[model samples]
Target: MKRKCPKVKSLLLRLLLFRQTRPVFTEEEKTEFTRLYDRIIQDGGIAPYDSSYPKFRFLQYLSVTKPLLFHGSNYQGIEEFEPRRQTLFDGTYTDAVFSSADGIWPLFYAVLDRSGLTGNIRNGCIVSRRGERFYFFSLSVESEDRYPWTEGMIYVLPRDSFRQASEGKLYFDEWVSEKPVKPLFRLKVSPEDFVFLSRTTWHRSTEPLFKTYLLYKWRSKFGKRK
Candidate 1:
C-alpha cells in the first residue's frame, strides 16, 4: 500500500473536519467591537509583529514553544489535558485588565457558535473538552507591516507540518519560514471577522487588528474512526 502524502492528508482532514465562517455582527455591535478593539490597542493591547517568529500569549495554559498533547482517540478513548498556554503578546492587555468578563466574550461566542462549536463562556476564555478535543478561544487584531505593503498577513502551518516540527522531522523555524510553502492556508483577515483555528495549526499575523474567534484541538468529528 502506498503511504499517504502528509500535505494531501492535511488538506483532506481540513476539508472534512475544519469549518470557517464569518459571524453576523449587527451594525451597532460592530461599532462597539471596533470601539473596544481600538481602546485595547491604544492602551497597548497590540503585540509587536515579528515576521520571522510570531509569538502570541493565547491563554494562561498555553506555552509558545511546546505543543499540547492528549491521550486516546477522538471517538472513544481515555482523556487527559495539559494546561493552556498564556504569554502576553506585544499589545495585549495586562492581566489586570484582560481578565475582566465584560468586553468580548459574548460577541466571540456568538461568532464561535456560527462555526458549530457551542460552549459556555467564562472568565474571558472558553475550554471545551467535549470528548477527545480541546476548544479554545481568544481575541486578536491584525498587524501593520512597513515593507512590501503587507498589512494583516497571517501565516498558518498545517497540522502535519507542526507534527513534523514536533517530532524532529522538520525544524519549526524552517517549517514557519516566510518562503511560500504549498498546500498551506494564507489569508488577509479583517478585525470585523471572527476566525476559528486549530492549536496545532501554526499561525502568525503581521501587526495588530485581527480577531481569533477560536482555536481547537482534536481529531475532527469528520475524521475516519479506527
Candidate 2:
C-alpha cells in the first residue's frame, strides 16, 4: 500500500536538505563558552536530582540557571521559556540543548498521551546575509489529536549591520527596515503525517503552537562533528 503524505510533511522533505553555508565560530570560543556553562550550572544551585542523568531536571530547574547568559542584552529579540537558554555558535544563537553530543543532534521526542490541554509558544528572528543563510528544520508526528499551525520566519541583513543588532546597539528606527523576507513556503502536519521543513533560505518562527508531548529534535554540524 502506498502511504500518503501530509501537506506539511511533503513540503518539509523537499526543503530539509537545502541550506546556505556561512562562517562559523572558532573552536576556542565554543570551548570557552562550554567552560562558562559549567560554572553557571554549579553556581546557579541546580541540585543533582539523579546523578545518573546529569541533566534530567533541567526543565524543572531552569530559574536558578538563567544567569549564565546576559538578560535581554547580548542577543536581542529572542525569548526562551524557563529551562532554556540561548546557545552561541560561531556568531549565531539558538536554544541550548540539554544533552547534545557527537552522533546526537538535539532531538526532542515527546509523547502527548494526556487528556489535559497544553501548548508552547516559540518566537525568534533569523538573520542572514546576501551570501550567508541559515536552515531551520523541524519534524512533527501526531496522534489522534490534530496538529496546530507552526509559524516560522526569517530576516536578512548586511553582515556589519547584523553584528550591531545582535549587540543591542542597533537603532530601532534603522533596524526595523531589516525584517526578513516572506517565507518561501509554509505547511501543516497532521496526525497521519510526518513533516520536516527547512528555513535555510532565511526564516524564523513567530510564536508557533505545538500540542503537549510533541516529539522534537535539533541536529547540526556541531553534533555531527563532535
Candidate 3:
C-alpha cells in the first residue's frame, strides 16, 4: 500500500519521529509473534536461501528481542561467524558479528543481486515484528529496467552469544558479537518465496533507500504513541 506520513520537515512533525529504528509491533502482533516464536522454537527443519535454486520459504517467527537471531549472506553453510568491520554504501559500523532480530530482514542480503549497479536494486525488505514485510516493485517503473536474482542464505544463531549493539538511530534490528560464533542453523530462500510478485500491492519510493529506512524508523518509534 502507498502510505505517506507527514514530511520530515517541521520540528513538530519531527517530534512525531521516534528515536528507535526498530519496528514497534502492535498488541495483536505481539501475541501472534509469541505464538509463532514458541512454535518455531519447538519445530525443526528450517534451512537455506539460494536465489537460483530457492527452496522452502523462510518462516516468520519475526521478533526483535527473542533469543534467536539471523544473519544474511550470499554464501552458505557458515560453520562459524566472525566479527568484522561491515562497510556499506549507507554507512559503516565497527568490527563485530552482526545479526538482526527480524528473521526476514536478512533476506535482502541473502538474495541481493551482487551486480555492478546494485545500489539501485528495487528489492526492499521492511523489518518489523508484524510479518517483516518485503517491498518489491516494478523493474521498469522509473529507473533501471533490469533486476538480477542471486543466491543467498540466512544464518540462524543463538542470541546469548552476542550483545545488542544498536548504537545508531536507524538500525535497532541489528545485533553484534565480538567473538566467533556458530549458527544454530541456516535457511535457503529464493525470490519467488521471498517476494510474492503476483498479488502483493507495493509502494514505489525514489527517495534513497536510507531515507526510506528513516521512514520506517519514524513509524517504528513514534507510530505507537497516542
Best by lDDT: 3
Mark the 10 consecutive residues where model 3 has the least summed lDDT: 1-10
TM-scores for candidates 1 onward, in order: 0.21, 0.19, 0.53
Q: Please write out the lDDT profile of model 1 over residues 132-184, one tens digit for every residue.
A: 11123422111111111112322222222222111221111111111222212
The models' CA-based lDDT, in order, is: 0.24, 0.24, 0.51
Candidate 3 lDDT over 39-91, as tens digits, reads 65565335312223222222343444556778878787678888888733245
The better-scoring model by lDDT among 2 and 3 is 3
Candidate 3 local distance difference test against the native? 0.51
How far in Å is the alpha carbon of 16 misplaced in model 3? 13
Residue-level lDDT of model 2, residues 90-128, one tens digit each, is: 334443322211000111111112233243222122223
Which stretch of 10 consecutive residues in model 1 shows the poorest summed lDDT?
69-78
The number of the candidate with the highest TM-score is 3
What ranking of all candidate models by lDDT puts the best one first?
A: 3, 2, 1
